[model samples]
Target: MINVNEVVETNEMIEKENLDVRTITLGISLLDCISSDLEQLNKNIYNKIYEAAKDLVATGEQISREFGIPIVNKRISVTPIALIGGAACRTKEDFASIAQTLDKVAKAVGVNFIGGYSALVSKGMTPADKLLIESIPLALSTTDVVCSSINVGSTKTGINMDAVRLMGTIVKETAEATKENDSLGCAKLVVFCNAPDDNPFMAGAFHGVTEADKIINVGVSGPGVVKTALEKVRGESFEILCETIKKTAFKVTRVGQLVAREASERLGVPFGIIDLSLAPTPAIGDSVADILHEIGVEHAGAPGTTAALALLNDQVKKGGVMASSYVGGLSGAFIPVSEDQGMINAVEAGALTLEKLEAMTCVCSVGLDMIAIPGDTRDTTIAGIIADEMAIGMINQKTTAVRLIPVIGKGVGETVEFGGLLGYAPIMPVNQFSCDAFVDRGGRIPAPVHSFKN
Candidate 1:
């Protein structure tokens, strides 16, 4: 029934190339879990995650074994806790308890991480939303599996200057509180301008208000596959390289669509979006940086690399568009510094720097991810990083975010470990120049040139 030549072509195309699926995320909406009583809400949170995610690890494992492709992380993203938990929570203690309960269920079910411990305050913040924001450090530091996010802006609502200001402080506190492990918990958090709700990725993933009440979304990863495809035609035309990536992405996303449909049927939740991101791991063969190398750059920081990435990103979208009708989230490529060994190595080798990373944000899926700065970096500097990245996304009308950790007591070139799947980062320097004027201009940058289109 199948074409033998096509099968062989795909095989020959992928031989010697290391490819693996990144995350098969289960997006569970917590709107139904809200209740007037704190006790009832807690009960609903536990039951929903456990019931929805109980078979997730097993399903992912079975699929990985069936396909001979390694599925790295099994994760879940929920509705922002503040929206669901605020009704019953009157104090930080009540909110902290809810965060603790969510973390417990994630570990119990063996998920790599649980996201959506978040708040969306682009327009304004509610009393309970304010409390949850204040408790982020305590919530994250006390929980192992809980990851948090805050959506401070969007194309429709514009950037919330006040919320952005609060987030800068919260991020700093989160880093300080968890400084023991190189401020690792800060690495698990994200601040976004236009974050999607059905995102099946971590650190920043959360079920959005527009998403289904319950659904299964898959974040398919195959950087190694793409890199492998590039290796086949070392001297091929750039157009040919792009074509190869597009074809490979088509196959990778097809696999993700299959997994999402099957997983949804098994769980009885509606099938959700498939995130086609090149999510790399700490392992040797799973690097996005490697793909850049295969594309002709010795490392990610080489010249012409940004243009190459833009091409790779565009081709991936072209392939993904044909594979699935429903595609969303920050899908394309990820460059998490600590998580990808090649990126970490590049930073340590002086081939990468914070400013260059900022430049890359213009062409990548996420921005300034997993970067570490000196412990003594001023709060204004961190806020400056957030503002710069947010401005890029705001201007381009894309979903870009930052997850930078200011490792307490660590200076440039020093390595800080967050243990397990979080990996580690060598501290990089931030500009010593003051952003006082830029940050103080804080009212709001307003929507950019394109944002004004009629």
Candidate 2:
């Protein structure tokens, strides 16, 4: 089982191809931390997260050093605060106080970000869910490391148009609240359809109520490695090309499997899924768009882009599932505009647009991710966009998320710098056409006929 060539190949991927374990996320459930007393609830939440993740960063670093694999981030995802704070959080501020506690524990444990300042309202919002949803703007604005997400739709439950409409206004408020930082608060917030519980990624990661009390999940990324493999079979037949990608993905995911097992064993936590997403960075060569280009697209949003992405996504799953028994989360290619330089280049070259990106999300892992839009764009328009994406997930029964930054004081044709992993984005124009009447219909979009399978 131990092959010298495979070891050398993995080293090459790491050293030359930007292959790395994207994140080692500790999922800690906050259900037990719930209390009727607000102060006690906050304190209990803080201590639970702190104890669960205190060794996370150090453990990740140790594994990286020992194995010579780069582990990019150590993070945590907790149960939705709405559920945990239901009894104590009477107002939006009360929920925001919970976010502050999350931020404090994240800093104390030394993780990059902590997710699940979230409310799951795929069908309807409860009193607690509504409070947490309303608190997102304040919670994200005040906290440094805490991230928030709202699940507004799911296949089984249908889309909550009310939540979608409110999120549109909430997104705008978040942008205004953090305008000084180029709407960085919005960068940490996401809206999802069919959001996964054990997603080792942010700003969508949350410990689903179904997960164990504590577990370790790892996300691995290697777009450059995939591209490099495809290059070797350039101009080859479709069969050959697909074979190349599958083999390459298998190798890359094996690295994640190793890391996940080691991290779990060391941390004394059960190992969760390995999210083998082709999560690109701002770094050149590490882009899913580049992989698409290697697969025969001139640019990411080109005519055959969606088909190309579907192929890649399918093969990635086919190969990755073989590498580990537990393969979950959004396990495919991520097409975040700001995070991938190739996508950024595509946008600037006018080869990619919001419309094209939305079409692409039908095949990719996530939806309309890390996109910056004009501040003046109406919240109704944003609601309409979210509804459209959610409809895609509902019909297709796949996970799709939106992490849009409506950069305040910015408009189309301008660029906003988010720095680090968020990278920068050229503000893209949105349809000026009004969708107020459509969004004003404040009711749920019933689940599709396929959802009644049982």
Candidate topping TM-score = 2
Worst-scoring 10-residue span by lDDT in model 1: 9-18
Report the number of the highest-lDDT candidate: 2
Worst 10 residues of 2 by lDDT: 46-55
TM-score of each model, in listed order:
0.94, 0.99
List runs of model 1 lying over 4 Å from the truth. 1-16, 440-442
C-alpha local distance difference test of each model = 0.82, 0.94
- In angstroms, the error of model 1 at 47 is 1.9
lDDT of 1 by residue, 1-454 (tens): 4488856654543344445556878888889999979999999999998998899999888876775556778998888999999789998888988999999999999999999989887677889888998999999899988999987777766777767777778888888999887787788789887888778888898888888777788888878778777888898998898889999899888878877777777667788888898888787777888888888877778787788778888899889979998888888988889888888878877887888888888888988898888888877777778877887788778888989898887898688877655678888888999976666666655675566667
**How many residue pairs collide in each prediction?**
1, 0
Clashing pairs in 1: 197-208
